[model samples]
Target: MKKKLGMFAGLVLFVVLMAACAADSSQEESDSGDSNSSGSEDSSAENQDTTEISFIHWRGEDEEVFDDIIGQFEEENPGISVQMNTYPSEQYQSNAQQMLRDGSTGDVFTSFPGTQFETINNAGFFTDLSDEEFVNNFAETSLEVGQSEGSQLAVPYQMVFNMPVYNKGMFEELGIEVPTSWSEYQAMAETLKENDITPIAFPGADIGPNQMMNSMMMNNAKNEDIFAQLESGEETLTNDWWINTLEDFQHFNENGYLQEDALGTNQDSAMQMVADEEAAMLATGSYHMASLKELNSDLELGFLPPITVSEEEVEYEGIHTATFMLAVNKNSEKKEEAKAFIEFLSQPDIASQYANETGQHLTVNDVDYESESLQNTSHWIDEKDTRFQPRYLIKEAAVEDAVLGSIENVLGGTSPEEAADEAQQVVEENID
Candidate 1:
């Protein structure tokens, strides 16, 4: 009986040992399966190919912001990546033209509206965004730039209008009010001169000022559709609107309304005049407000369009053009990725992000920036009922010969009519 009991105990011990061995084997298999699963996941991740697209623009100072935007986009879409390229603004136009000619440009690039931009857009180098859903995101009238024959060529990131900037402090202290007519503006200039103040520091020495000045004068024209006529060679600078404009330039030069050695004064000196309170107003680029504020934080600057051709003008109508825009390469192999980047740029937050950094305004409707200066400029633009046309309505080369040279000729003692005739001949020769 004792032997049988010992044998039974031995059998029970053997059964418990077998059960422990089976549990250990099952645990080892589970661990091996998990290791294989993890390896497979890592291998899959390594094998995935991300689509890469290139975005080239001319804003060197804004490169950091673009990088941040691109980073965020890549994180959201791990399957896509972007490469950013910055080019100098001065050389961008020619470089872009060369790139188009070579078919070696990046997937996306920046473009403006003008004879050159039109020539490029008409050449089918840029994809049409007219029917894109993102097209509705642009501000009113801002989307018209870079458009040809109802097809939108690029997305206007901002609406740039080059007009005069007045010193709000000077206006308040001297009891000067904003002008609503050509005569009123003239009177204000005369008053400032009488008070021993340089009325306006005109940057006549710079090449761009003339084109902008032409746009300002054209804003008050009796015929605003003059661009179409000018382009078609059906109109000349000797027309009534242009005649009045040339006469106005002569009047400014003769009456000491413009600074002394005005042709010698560059943009920096012109802006400096306003900053030092030696001048009450300045005619410069659209983005000067940020720099002026940086120079004098206490300075209250306000933007003003040209007073109308006459006293009948009620609204401050001017040309609105895209100074910088995003154009997708139509020949891009990664067209889908390029389009995705542009669509991303269409968001209000993205459009206004640069404004926050530099106080430059964006063209997206209802988009706002945190910059106080930008807000103030926007307020004035809205209150004055500003209207817009393509900022690049005329050719830059033609403007240099006809308009800038016309102003210089008038300053050099040529009669306004003769200057106008000379300008008309130049326009007839160079008009696009």
Candidate 2:
């Protein structure tokens, strides 16, 4: 399984971040209101000297593209220049949090859409972009995910669609059409298992399980106002969507439909099973397609909405989870300069360039995905039938952590009901 950035890549990000750390004293001066003394507030509107601002982000692979974008921004706005710095994923959040808390985070930084972004926004760490012209470029739903309590605290850079990516060739060979209903899906799994083929590659890890939970919630619990009920203390994970989804997952586990020792399998291993023709399907988000293709260039992939637990109420839908919420640090003295960068990137052509290069969908209007694998899922999103991951409604990490643990337990021989009840207890104890 792949883990960690390569040594050379880690060193590059480390050195860049180290240079950014040199601006620490400037943050103290900015926080003290000393930097504002040089120019009257209105002078910026008239004419201002060229200013340099810092930008910090987490994706190492995006450094070159970001630097190119910065270059374009500088060319467009001769008065502002953006300096870019990046870090590996593990160190990114911790360092970004500490820097922001200390009022030393650079002028611009990237945030996530879930609990991490929620915590930072509530801390007043980001400027509100709700009324900015650049914000108007965002898709309505993307803006909704990037906002907190109706305030657009950040701008989304790219979008994600999480669905099952199956081997199209394998399905064709098995004479299996893409299953639209739950029972049909089960039948397909049974046929694969009887033929001594692993029906699906479920990495016994938590992410695929989490994706399953989101799918079930979107399908079966849509009418229940599940999040509202959880918020009001009128419901818990032990009921309805939570229990049924857990049991459905357990059923797949006990029936040998999922590859053995799924709990011990890592995501890359699960994907490898599909690549090597040992399994016919894998549940994942579109973001992994680039990496999967790198592993098996000949792989013919197709996205499928997972079969829901209930066929009576809702039909299957693809899932969309937005990523890379770009925010101007509230404490940065160069916020105006940061906003210039945001505005520059918001241009449809510029945003599409970034999206096309990165294999992600642009959050702004009219920018299409360049990845063929991602394009396979675009029809659902284009038709507005896709759902956001359930985590968007959840603000606590405990919800996911508990649910993933229950999945592991279910695979380890625990009764689905008992395990699900325990999962509910986790949410009950952790709800804010």
Write model 2 residue lDDT over 31-103, tens digit each, in one string: 4433443466675444346576778888888788888888889888987767678888657766677777654
TM-score of each: 0.81, 0.83
Pick by lDDT: which candidate is best? Answer: 2
Pairs in clash, predicted candidate 2: 204-262, 204-263
lDDT of 1 by residue, 150-199 (tens): 78888778666566777888888999888777888888888899889998
Question: What C-alpha lDDT, on a 0 to 100 scale, does residue 78 get in candidate 2?
Answer: 85
Candidate 1 lowest-lDDT run of ten:
30-39
lDDT of each: 0.71, 0.74
